[model samples]
Target: MGESDATIVSMILAGDPRGLNRFLSRYGHMLAEYIRALTGDDNDLFSAVYEDVLVDILKQLRVLAGTHETPEIKKLSGKGELLRPIFESAARTVRRRFPDLLKASEEPKASPLPVDDLAAFANSIDHVDFKTLLEGLAGPERELLVLRYRLGFDYAEISNIIREARVQLEERLVNARHHFRARLFASQQKAMV
Candidate 1:
């Protein structure tokens, strides 16, 4: 059944059981991975959290099935359009049932997206702007950009790779961030002017 995400979402909202089964078959692993990401490697905790999050998701789907007024509902299309609620429910369930895990995860963690090094730059720029800025970075400065956004390898990993001390690697990243930000700020000013 190669139905589009919009079709599956509509089916779900219309109370078709197959709609939810299709959704779970499509995105179950994503939900599990998200739970794992938030809760860390407490392997057994996965089932408990997954069950709670699943229940929350089902409850949400049931409510949405009865909804009528949300104009945004009409705008949905791809799988991308349907995932927001599942993620929000997962986050809410983790917060409510495992407040400790949620609290600890609030501290910044490494991510696949290179946000820690870019810091303010990452926050202020859109994806195209970020790619443009990344293109501007060059030489060792480019490679040495410490990625501490999702997978946890920080300066130490970069230092090990480049044969620099952790302190030196961090300093280089700081310089790279400042240089990157200066270019971004200049571009913003240019656009404004």
Candidate 2:
């Protein structure tokens, strides 16, 4: 919905491969981070799933192409309905490709976070401040958090990706926040003691 995203979407619809690459570059770190949260240090699984997700996104590029002849979809609002389905489908592909990674691993070691707009994501790792707490959450809970926070997605888009009710997803996020806060406070108390 931001100006940059709108421009990038337009570029992609215009058949600008460079624009599509830039678009992906912008969200690439978040995507990698999201997957790392899911797969932990399972680099093999992460790489495979990540590639699959990208491939899926690339294929969906045609959808954004807005018809090879007319291409009016490029002129719409950047946050068009078309983008939602593309991202949702990509996330589902990732989930399908690697279902149990989060549950069966130690902390995920993500690929090098993309340098694109490093300033934007510089604090992402710290701002979230709940990575450890996330380890205890179920895979779906972790996935939702990654999508919402890391990927900058709203609940409706997240619902599309995970196929869950908005209310249920919101409740899960709230619970995860509370759980992490409690743990942080407990750790602080122990340190003070």
Instruction: Give lDDT tens digits, candidate 1, residues 83-117.
Output: 65665576567667876653311112222333344
What is the number of backbone collisions in each predicted candidate, taken in the order shown?
Answer: 6, 3
The TM-score, computed over Cα atoms with residue i paired to residue i, of candidate 1 is 0.47
- What's the CA error at residue 110 for candidate 2, in Å? 28
Worst 10 residues of 2 by lDDT: 104-113
- Identify the candidate with maximal TM-score: 2
Candidate 2 ranges with C-alpha deviation above 4 Å: 1-17, 63-67, 70-72, 75-83, 102-130
Candidate 2, residue 6: how far the Cα is off, in Å? 8.2
- Cα lDDT of candidate 1 equals 0.59
> How close is every model to the real structure, measured as TM-score?
0.47, 0.65
Please give the lDDT score at residue 162 for candidate 1.
40
Give the per-residue lDDT of model 2 (tens digit) for 32-82: 887777776678978887888877876666665556444445454554344
